[model samples]
Target: MQKSIAVVFDSAGTLLHMYRVAKDMSSGDLLTGVESTDLVARRKGRALIVLHTEPSVILAVDRNMRVIDFIDGHDIAIDISCASVPFSVEEAYDIIKDSDIRVDDILQVVGVVRKHCPEIFYVAAGIIVDRNDHSVPYVLSTGGRLFHDSKETVDRLKGLGVSVFIASGDSRRNLKQLAECMGISMERVYDIATTREKARIILELKDTYDKVLMVGDGMNDILALRAADVGIVTLQQGDHRPEKLEMSADVVIRDIREVLGIVESL
Candidate 1:
């Protein structure tokens, strides 16, 4: 049967109220008052590799050394995904080729990190790469709670027979937990989606669903938002919405709950 409608959601700023912390590789400074998107936007590289592990796990790995040093010393080639403005997996890997990291080492490091920092909900380790020069300047960790309306919105959409999906540049481990919390199946969640991949998801869903709506709050979502049958941008994250991001959406809403009304109108 052809589904009546499908809604694709962006996780971090759209559905989750994220609290992000970044460690400056060069200065050893921890930045608290910043958004991950903001950090990515300010950097010349505009690319991020998201590590799929709990934040505490990453924090527990060699706390004595700097995050960059630990990443440079180990093998992080496994369970890592990239989000870039216009870069591919091969290009992302090429940038970090000299790090001497591989996936097996990352798995072992995550186990050690998890044993120590069990309180953290999410953790990811990835370098911000400048594609032009192939220089990595930073590593970061992020954790956050779901928005108050996230579950309610998901439940309401499902009740109305609209399929819900999550496509974001986050760790698969974190996205799995989020899927469980929101009653969304794992198959519907697309983790570590780059800008182009998000758009592709929307295009693919159009084949099965009569209508598709993409809801997001950041620059990464621009392509998906543009591709959807009805593109919606939410401002509930309370961050500064870039003009280009807002302009891409068919409708701009303040709260996620407004989606219910939009569905009704459709």
Candidate 2:
């Protein structure tokens, strides 16, 4: 059976009201209330690597094994497969090693985060690495609550027979919790997804659904937004939208609930 419509959403800024904090490895400066995409966009050779384990686990590993030493010794490639499931400390070590980043640099950033941001819940921990120089320029930690209208919007979309999927660059562990909270199945979530992967998901969904709609709020969502049948960019996050990002979408909206009306009109 062909589904009438499928809506793909970006998790962080789209459905979650994110509070992001980043540590600049070079200057030892802490940047609060920043956008992750804007940080990545402003720098070159930067790729955001999301860790799929709890912050406590990483802290534990750092205490016993010394995160710097473990990563310095291990030579592994970044494995996206581990993103889909919860990973062990050993797996997390390997994932960090894959970045080919200088372990010492990242450790300092992690240390600063531990000292200053003790109260944050830490929904996601990410490293912004310079792929060319093999150094971590920034380490970021994010915590967010689901938008007030997020779950209701999801329920409303489902009532209208629209399939909802979350495709984001965030960790799967967090996305799983979000899926459960929104009553979306785990199978519909794509975690640690790259920009290309998000677009690919939209393109593939087009084969089974009559139309595909992508709703997102950042530069990272540009590719997927353009690929969908209807690309909707939501400004509910209240962040500054880049001209390029806004131009990529077919429609611009202020709230996620507006999607229900757009879907109905389609």
Candidate 3:
């Protein structure tokens, strides 16, 4: 088999669509970033900042110069359950927005906490940088597909004498689980991966492969799509929506069936 590849897509709109844990399919957005993946860390850190706090003194500014208490997580009774991380109270508050913690629930929780405990705040030094630090594990990120026919796709690609790999910005655990469910190898799947790194991987593979195709949805898919020889966008209509993703894509399709054809065309 001649070494040739084409067709890459964004996850959410391109591959599979996933619904949030307890929310409707339309609950979340497609633009999640690095901080979004470290949500557990951000949430635990935020909970810790609220420990032992007086709500009245939490410094916060509303529209029109109103220093209303930060009505989000500034109010959770921060006892000691979440006191391990060395992040600050302010950091916690800001971090909440970046985390994948349910927006409606945690925001309401944080707002309620702020109403009661505003004074007790601690600032943990050391911002959590998104760089590939030694502490960061190997990550895989997807655009938005929860379940996929990746096994057939990868197997076909491999049979065609191609090395196939998966990358996603979704939950690493979730991707691992899905790969298992699909009977695809874990070595091929990547979860909770950053957008930049996804593109970097495509570029790295470009060195070895005669051609590489990266696919995705949303803005994060932009870089990888451009990096590949052919960019593909996938979209779904039942509840999960990705209307605008195909605008920047070279070709848009509904399933993985078209992948090999695109490569053949090239």
Q: Which tens-of-lDDT digit does each residue in 150-183 have in candidate 2?
A: 9999999999889999998877778888888889
lDDT of 2: 0.74
Ranking by lDDT: 2, 1, 3
- Among these predictions, the greatest lDDT belongs to 2
Candidate 1's C-alpha runs over 4 A off are: 1-3, 26-28, 64-75, 78-85, 88-121
Range of the 10 consecutive residues with the lowest summed lDDT in candidate 1: 100-109
Q: Is candidate 1 or candidate 3 better by TM-score?
A: 1
lDDT preference between candidates 1 and 2, better one: 2
The TM-score values for the models, in the order shown, are: 0.81, 0.81, 0.51
* Backbone clashes counted, model 3: 43
**Displacement of the residue 89 alpha carbon in candidate 3, Å:** 14
- Clashes per candidate, residues 3 or more apart or on different chains: 10, 0, 43
Local accuracy of candidate 1 as per-residue lDDT tens digits, 1-266: 53499999999878887655555545655565356666677755557776534444554566455434544566444333434456665666666664433333334334443444456455455556557667555555555678889999999999999999999888787889889999999999998887788999999999998999999988889999999999999999786888998999999999999999998888
